[model samples]
Target: MHIKYTISVIFIVTLVIIEKENNIISKVSDKLSTQLTPILFGPSLSAPHNASADQHEDRLLENSTWSTQQSSSPASASGGQKHILLLATTRTGSSFVGEFFNQHGSNMFYLFEPLWHVERMLSVESGGTNASVAGPAYRDVLHQLFLCEFSLLESFIEPAPQDHVTASLFRRESSQSLCEDPVCTPFVRKGFERYHCRVRRCGPLNLTLAAQSCKQKEHHAIKSVRVRQLETLRPLAEDPRLDMKFIQLVRDPRAVLASRMVAFSSKYKIWKRWAVGEDLPVDEDEVRKLKGNCDNIRMSAEIGLKQPPWLRGRYMLVRYEDIARFPMHKATEMYSFIGIPFSATVEEWIQHNTQASKEVSGVYSTQKNSSEQVEKWRFNIPFKLVQLVQQVCGPTMTLFGYKFAENKDMLMNKSVSLIEERTFL
Candidate 1:
């Protein structure tokens, strides 16, 4: 009887040890996977390492629901001026538009693709993109990150009482709590603290400490530019502290397709699947032909129309052609729409920094002068393809005041003759 009792005790002890080991192994595996996996958005692409691994980990911990602290300080909350966010497909001149605003001396800042951070974080948490399918948890995580980034910005500009108190009393306290997750905590804290130091002396107790806590000057603006994460932006629009304007940039679909073919082939490979005839690798030739197709332009227009109405008036559709023809006028109009005064300095900057003059059919190189390249699509594309594009995207083209060749055959014949004449000359 004694031997049987001893054997039962040993069995129970072994089971507990095995269970504990399994839990530890599971946690270690999760951390390793999160570290090793590549972050992806739309397709596989690398994200800028804006923060250190330790900062990222801390950000995650701080963002966890169980980790948050109740607000201990009171600060007045009020609405502020609306921030303008530019949204568009790649190669549609969104960057140029953003640069125009940046030169206009508005408090505006340009961010390349801010939503990538949230997407990467969610992917890590969910194990992969497949697991992050459209769901409540995915939506919630996205929303939280958006809100946290925005709130961090607000704390910098106008520190809440809690922020003020925290910065002053516990100067070493982690600012990662301000962000939804701890991943970006150190970066945020360092940035804000730097800003605070610039204006005032650093110490254990003051509003200046809060202001200097931000690491990046444009943290708020940068966080706002992630258009793919529109769902996150929606709730933020309601906050009185934030006034939001969305500028949806639309271009001829052919131009968009052509540009994407060159610029985003690796990032958006699915585009290659849409190609017809000869199974051509999405190369420069296909990009050029596609650029002149009206159907491609129409598809882009459809995308614009499908967006919410509140986003429409806030959006001003600019044609690549018009921008090329009247750069100053379009620039002026854009500034006015965004409620910023245009200046001679802005004009000079546009002339100096513009990429409208450079030519590359389907490829976008970061080294190319963008302002000079803006309207070069007209010279390289074939007339027949242009007509086909006009035929397909006629309604939208007409709506946007795009002029089409009166006779498709005549235009093609003229183009061919001109090419021959140039060759002979």
Candidate 2:
């Protein structure tokens, strides 16, 4: 009996040692495979071997930890449904990024700037930002929309959605999801149905139909610039009915201001006035407003990056510069983060849109020679304003890897890269 007990103990110990060795070997093999494989998504052009920063940038793009682990399967809520919010401010290339999901497939229901109406309604009686009444109002509307409840939205729509139907839905045509099928006129040619709403020749959008479409979709995404703070969205993220994820998109403040100047010339008339070599008062109202905006952006980003309990595995930070430089690559990362397959249809759209034969210009047009668009502002914005922006938005810029320009010459030199390669998460 003693001999048998000794033999059994030896056998058990042997099995334990083998199991430990197997685990170590498996982990090492995975690490080696990951290192050896080329990044799944990266720029078409390779950087010089000697350029360490460029090499680091490529690696950063490859290793984004949007979810706990990268997998081929989609990470979704309990019911196989997902909700995504593309959080960005004006002129931050959100519309361009939003299109990635918009073109995703029949499974995605994308809403473009649905919160524009809420902002417009409250702009007249605004009491500054945080104190403004629009804060809770914006959140409430978004909460309802995520649930496919449109009655709250109808309250804000101009001309009112009578019995939950109206033609005045803000930017209705931009959303292909709203432009097709039961919501849009069915008689139009199949291929052209997406563009039918652009002409407004179709009948009004029935809120009932829109809600039905939203419910039928497997996933939903909304792109909005209205929500100012990340913490304010905690309620939506914690809601049991929704599986919410946020992609906070930011751009270099200098580029944003430069783009806005051209896009909203009338609103930025004061900026143009200061562009003629006049001295800028950093303490003035315009400058203070710019500073405040930067503060808000940086603070919100800080909160998201901290990965608070409600946001863990649900928050992603993306820079517009990275996307502009490598649209398809960044789009792949985003879709992966949201636990969705990056479709070839989105790939084709990026190819066509980013490499336009000629420069297509519009205040809101997504088409551009993407790489060229990143530095276009370096030539357009005066050095004085650039300096002012850096003074006010320095922390935000530094956090997102935007390097400061030492002088006007360095700012204009296309070879001296202003964006650094930094990894978040």
Candidate 3:
């Protein structure tokens, strides 16, 4: 009996030792598999090899860490949604980028320039940008909008379209959605139907219900030119409830200056529409205009540099140059950062929309001649004006890493390369 007990105990001990060895072997095998995967595979068969492609790849690699990453599978990404704001100025391609999002967002609702109401309602001009009285008031209205509360959209305590949510900023998309059950006359055709079933409007009014019903959406976005200051929205960014992210869209000021100077027609006075004050001169002197645009951009960048730690992944700077050059890549990056799938519909929209509509941009026509458009500012703006703009905007320009053209000839003779953007590091 003693011999039998000893044998049994020995068998149990042998089994325990075997199990321990197997656990170590399995762990080591996993370690080897993980370490070897990147090496044994070489780069996946899909990496690009062209000279320009290599350059672009390097650019993307450089900026990869800036785009905030969150778990992006359908379940986590889509269900949570986000409130995205394009913190941009007019003529910076804000409209173009906004349109891109509105079309492809699928589950997202976009507002063109909701703040136009804040100014008209409070009788403040130019978005009340300074932290003075109107500025704070504007922010309060903005806060309410971001929260998906549309009660504020109702006409002011007294009824008036001028002071209502349907004020100047409503734009075609919002205006059309106001068409009620019977559908209002002077209908808006810019996808007004998104609100039809849910809107149930009357006298083209009753949009409060539709706007408040935004809780079900995967995302809500607003594109505004009124917001030139980045820090102005700190309250929203810090709020865990707002779930907001911002994209700072910047364009070459030279290009921006040239685009504004293009002769305006009654049909496409897009630049004039950027005005804030009702009494602000329609045609400000070119020098003053250049200064204003440059200052706004310069300030935005400087402010971004001073952003607090909480905003690290929340604020992203996107260059029109990069978007123009690699629309697909940039779109994919932008959509991913916003927590949405860059679906095939987005791809198809891009393929068809590469030719920007002639109506908005005029001669520059969104035809998207890509690299060529970068040089247009050089050729379109007189050599003298270009030099002056460079002089007036030099420090601000350098702050954002925009290298000036050595000479007008260099604009064409020299190949232009864009410096990605200012790096906080």
State the lDDT of candidate 1 residue by residue for 111-201, as single tens digits.
3343443334444544443321322222332332222223222221223335444332121221221221221233332324422322223
- Cα lDDT tens digits for candidate 3, 350-390: 66666555454455233454544554666665555567678
- Decide which is better by lDDT, 1 or 3: 3
Give stretches of model 1 more than 4 Å off.
1-80, 120-233, 265-313, 343-345, 355-375, 378-425
> Tens digit of lDDT per residue, candidate 2, span 49-163?
6868768666545443432232223343336778999999999999989999899989999999888876665543232332235566677678778878776667666666667
- The prediction achieving the highest TM-score against the true structure is 2
What's the lDDT of the predicted structure labeled candidate 1? 0.43
Question: After best superposition, candidate 3 residue 356: deviation in angstroms?
Answer: 4.7
Best by lDDT: 2
Number of clashing pairs per prediction, in order? 48, 0, 2
| Candidate 2 regions with alpha-carbon error over 4 angstroms | 1-78, 125-131, 186-196, 199-201, 279-283
Model 2 error, position 379 (Å): 0.8
Error of 2 at 48 (Å): 70
User: Which pairs of residues collide in model 2?
Assistant: none
A best-first ranking of the candidates according to their lDDT comes to 2, 3, 1
lDDT of each: 0.43, 0.78, 0.57
